[model samples]
Target: MNAVLRRHAGYYLPFLALAAVLAVFPLVASTNMVNIGVFALIYGIAAIGLSLLMGLAGQVSLGQAAFFAVGAYTHAILVTRYDVHGLVAAVTAVLAAMLVALLVGLPLLRLRGHFLALATLGLGIIVSVTVRELEYTGGTSGIFGIPKPEFGGRVYDSPREFFWLLVPFVVVGLLMARNLVGSRTGRALSAVNDSEVAAECLGVNTFLLRLKVFVLSAGYAGLAGVFYAYWLAVVSPEAAGFLLSVHFLLMVVLGGLGTVWGAITGAVVVEGLDEGMKALIPRIVPGATGEVQLIAFGVALVLVVILLPGGLAQLWEMAVSRLRRRGSAREPGELPTVAVREGPRDDVPGTGEVSLADLLAEADVPERGTVVLSVRGLTKRYGGVVAVDDVDLDVRAGEILALIGPNGAGKTTCFNMISGVLEPTAGTIEVLGSRVEGRAPHTVADLGATRTFQNLQVFGSSTVLGNVKVARHLRSRSGVVRGMLGLAAREEKEIERSAMASIAALGLAQDADRSVTDLPFGRQRQVEVARALALAPRLLLLDEPMAGLSGAERDELAELLRRARDAGVAVVLVEHDVDAVMALADRVAVLDDGRLIALGTPAEVRNDPAVVAAYLGTDDEADDIVRHAAQEVR
Candidate 1:
């Protein structure tokens, strides 16, 4: 319980600090300053949502102002025309915005990058134009006379009161955002941002997760809009204008991309700067207009992007990190080491090597040998060319099936099809009895199959432990609400423990806290393996897992795979290293020119004439290579 309290204190302490500061601001500031604070707080709310969408989820949106307008208009119409209670109307308005976001996101989120940005930009324009034309919205004038919110018959009318009212919402927003980005769901979001395909391969529903964040961010914008309407006692079409959406984006960018506090900081800086320029620019320039302020913003944005791409939050974090490092300076030439658990190992007699047979014999583990992955007549065609043709295979538990072929022989393509990264042009795939040929990767993963990529898909922005924890996403049951409420603490701790075990299994426990990008190429591959192992899948597909490894690293990885197989995991390894394939595989499936040429025990496949021909084209050199590899395996 003390551990849990300590964990939670780290999150809430900042909230209390923020709350205390907000509580004191109104007491000390003048009325104009208080009014500015209100605007900053409102924009801060919207910016927080934007930060989650773009900074964390790696999604871009230009339709946030549309949701903002939806909230303001909905609240204003509800209170003035329908005489709804202010608080109830506020809640309804936020829901309305979220509903609109759901509707828009269903179709719009399908597009990515600039396409999604432009689609949202168009949505903002459409909302702006629609509000101007709609009669109930009061045309271009927009709905007005929005009543102030009341609690127990006490109205919040003054800027000071409104500022105080807004503070709690900001605090709640920050707390929620902070909690979310630090939870399992947040790690999944970071995974999605880093690589959607990889995230899906780990059983993270990328599309659904993206949609949820979109809806949640829209809610934030809508709530801000509700406050905007009440505070101004008016709503206008301009409230949903494209410019306002740009401003929200700008605020998030300037403060920090992925940091929770960055959102609020950005809003305060941008809002404060805008007001300051409006008051100061004319006095300095004698005949300056709002256009000059726009120029100033443009210059500021360029400077921030060029010098501090991670934003002001990143700058502050760097400074703090540097200060801490200086305070705890290590002695020259001394290195930090973390204890790594290498797990139990068995060595083959006279070879000083860990062989598959040795591992199988040493462990008293039972072999289930149940077929976990069944692929029938799998084919992939690229317009006029067949990348993979009529491949049939089955991978059973407690076995390692190495899929090997020469370059362009469709080994990776076969893995892609089975893992659902690519839809088979023809044929069916069943993962643990579920038909999964054309399904999304996440669905296949959900059915107890997971895979690594030919190109490493480690989340470069995260630590090694963080990367592994993301693999445990499907194992946990936390959603945005639970995460935001800090109710997922126990589950998160369990996930970390599990992830750490996997890391330790791969001898990466020492590097658990290190950023994956800082590791060497070979170690990064181990990180990928550790992440895959963390999934605890029945079927594991590895595409070139030993590509960048040294001989020692390869041996360690082979041992790890043997251990996994001993524990009933069916691993399909696509690798070019013939020696590793011959030594480690229970069965070898050889592909040639998009066709499966041979499937049998590693020794059988290695000596097969078809396999030799496919690899070396019936040459004496090819025969020698195969013979030598076979001898090495023995």
Candidate 2:
């Protein structure tokens, strides 16, 4: 219990210090400075939400100000016109903003990059124009006479009082944001950001996850809006303008992209700069316009991007790392390179010095010969081009089936169709008896199928353990709310243990906490396999898993696959290494020009006259392909 408390204290001490500073600021600062602090805290809440959407989820939004205005105007209207309680009105306003985000996000989240940004910008414009023209919104003049929040017969009416009132909200918001970014949901969001297709194959519904983050972000903006309405006791159309939205984006960017503290730091910096300019500009230029402040902001943004692209948060991290390194003996960012102790040698030829019995022993082998994947007449076409012609395949438990062909033979297309990354032009795919041909990738994954990509899709920004943990998405049941509330701590620990087991099984335990991008290409491939194995899939698809590996690495991977087969995994490997495939596969299926030409035991397929003519083009090449297979089987 003490150890857990100490760990949590280390994690939260910075936030507690920040809250203390915020609480003490109003007591010492002048009224004008206190007012600026109030605005900063209010905008900090919205900026944190935007950070989660853009920084973590990699979804861009340019309509945060519209949501902010919705909250402010909704609260103002309810308080002034209907005489509603401030607390109830605040909740209602936040819900209204979330509803708007939900309606807008359903279709808009489908768009990517600048298209999504533009769509969100249009939404902002529509909201701004509607609020300006509507009578209930008080048109261009905006709503007035908003009531101040009262609690226990005490009213927060002054700038100092409001600043103090906002400190708790900002602190709670930061705590929740911190909790979320360290949870399973946050890891999945990072996975989606890194590779949406990879995340989907790991059983994450990318569209739904993006939509949920959007709605949550809008709720944050709305909460900020509620406070903004009460702070001024009036709401204006300008509050919902494009400029405010841009400022919110700027806050997150200037603070840091992926850190929760970046949001508050950015809000404070932007607000402070604006206030400083207002006071200093008049004295320097006598009649300087607001455009001068805009120019200053642009210059500052450019400088920050060029000098510190990761923003102020990056600078803080660097400083803290330096301090820790100075105090400790170890160098910063240095990871241990200790290898796992080798086990007893096995009977398998060319199995190398390292043994995998300890690694593979824990896998629960099902009844052998149980068919795990079935495909019949599967086809894929692009206009006049047929990528994959009618193909039939079945993979049973306890066997490794190699799908071999030349480049552009539609090997990957078959894998894509079977894994549900692409819809088949015709025919069916069943994994563990569930029809999955036209279903989404997540659905396929949920039915106990997982795959590794030809071009590596490991999450570059995450640690090896982190990458593997994302595969446990379907296995874990915690959602965004539970993650944010820190209710999934126990589940997260179990996930880490499972992920570590997979990493260890793949001989990557030493590098488990290292960022995957820092590893060699071969190691990264191992990471991908570790992630896939963590899913505990009944059927595993490997699109050239051995590509770019060394001879020794190839042997290691081959042995690993054999162990997986022994453990009742159904593996379909697509590869160009004929010797490795011939020696490793129980059966080989050959494809030529999108058509299956042969399927049989390695010897049977290699000696087939048609396969020899079509695949290798001659008997000499076919002989060369099977030289190793004959030696291994004998």
Backbone collisions counted per model: 0, 0
User: Which residue window of length 10 is worst by lDDT in model 1?
Assistant: 343-352
lDDT at position 216, candidate 2: 93
Per-residue CA lDDT of model 2 for 192-311, tens digit only, reads 989888999999998888898899999999999999999988898888899999999999999999998899999999999888877887788888899997677678778987899999
Clashing pairs in 2: none
| Top-scoring candidate (lDDT) | 2
Candidate 1 segments whose C-alpha is farther than 4 A from its true place: 1-7, 337-367, 616-634
lDDT of 1 by residue, 161-243 (tens): 98998998999889888888887778899988888889899999988888999999999999999999988999999999998
Alpha carbon lDDT of residue 323, candidate 2? 94
TM-scores of all predicted structures: 0.93, 0.93
TM-score of 1: 0.93
